[model samples]
Target: MSILASSFHEGPLLDKYNNLLISHERYRAMFDNIPLAYMSMNENAAIIDFNNAFSELTGYSCEEVYMKPFSFFLYDKKDIEYHVNVTFPRFKRNGFARNQPWKLKHKSGREIYVIVHGNVRYDTDGRFIQTHCLIVDVTEQRLAREECQRAESKAQLILDVISERVTFHDREHHVLWANKNARSNAAPEC
Candidate 1:
């Protein structure tokens, strides 16, 4: 028998209930499928739930991490210090945090750099309940940026050693950068 036919008779109430069920199902599907990592932690910072992406990122299954102190994942001393001294205090006061960078220890014992966006939840009685976090892995981006800076520094070193004066300019001929040699060898103003 069709679900509509089987479930307590068809009526406006049934239709409304069906629509709400469908909407909830759709929301669950999207939450599970989205690439971004999402997690919720209870007031004490214990893990409540996390999406698939978060599980993959942390290398910890929901079953393994559920109700565990989320702070246990933070292994780096610098990251821990910053989180405790700066991030947590700020978040507590503001009830939200954004673009907060921290490192988490993966299940494989490697550090994973992440940026977190979070919101705190409170009960009507002014009690803390849970906080939601949207985390993004930025390890690759940080490495690429460091690599780029190194390459630029190496190029600059080479440019500085050369005999020719090298000055970078904008389209309007405004000077943006000058190599060390360029600066030293620049002609004095008339």
Candidate 2:
């Protein structure tokens, strides 16, 4: 018999319960398949769950992280202390913390930057139960920022050369840029 048909004969409570289970499964599927790193911790700051993307980024399996103190992955002593001792406690008291950029050491000994949003979930008696994290790896973004800086430096060097008039722009039919050597060798008119 169809599950919905069975629930219908059982009563509204059964039908509602079945629907809730289905909804939870759907949400779980979406979470597991997400392309970004996702992690969750207990109120005690112990890692409880993480997604596939988290493993891909960190080079650590979910099994290695689960039930362990998440602070173990942090290479910065100050950051580790702040996150485990200060931030989680403040979040438990505050209910939520917005996106905060963090630097962490990966299993390969490379430092990666991530933006994290955390929220504290509470039990019925108002005690903190879990901390949920939505983490996004920003290593590529950091690299891009550095690349832009280098490109700006190179452009400045080109401008400095141009500003000295050591380079010349020539046009008759087509425009051409010539360096000091090329300009000195080219015919004055042509």
Candidate 3:
């Protein structure tokens, strides 16, 4: 039902159809440019199809990955094994999995970290048909976190070896961490 009624649309339905058609065309123009990668797999877990973002993220052409097991793109051996043996089966049973971590290797051998959100489709009779999934690329975020960890570890190691008393604290002045010398100095005398 449309908002303007009095005379009932004021004209034929052609104007309304034209408005809808124009709106759809504008949306279709943006569809291919969306940044979130999308993919779908058959019930067998084969890579059936993916969007342009997926192709850009993995550096693989549709022809190259077509019909391959989804796990085949994983970067680590353990991840591949776990996906095939655990995650896939769990998703099939649950019909949905969200924000599941995965590491995919690009065609150029770069590792890409991602969070997968997926849902399975079923036939009217309840047989599994396929899965629709979104792949959120998180490689830069993961790399930054790992880098920060390494930096902290290196700083801690240096602090541990120094003779000077060093302590880290929050704004409240409570000791959060104290290096070896700082710890010994704070200890009570026997």
TM-score of model 3 (CA atoms):
0.80
Q: Write the per-residue lDDT of candidate 1 for residues 1-190, one digit (tens) a residue.
A: 8885777467786888889999999998999889999988876677897889988988987788788776778978776677767777677668898898878999999978899999988789867778889999998998899899999999989998888889999999988889888898778989
Backbone clashes counted, model 3: 0
Tens-digit per-residue lDDT, 81-113, candidate 3: 999899999998899999999999999999999
> Each model's number of backbone clashes?
0, 0, 0
Q: Output the TM-score of candidate 2.
A: 0.68
In model 2, the runs with Cα more than 4 Å from the true position are: 1-21, 153-190
Candidate 1: regions farther than 4 A off: 1-26, 188-190
TM-score of each candidate? 0.79, 0.68, 0.80
Model 2 worst lDDT run, 10 consecutive residues: 166-175
lDDT (10s digit) by residue, model 2, range 1-190: 9986776779887778899999999998998889988888887778888888877878888788788787887769999999878887887799888877788889999998988888888889998888888888888999899999999778656765653544444565353554554556657785
Q: Give the clashing residue pairs of candidate 2, or none.
A: none
Clashing pairs in 1: none
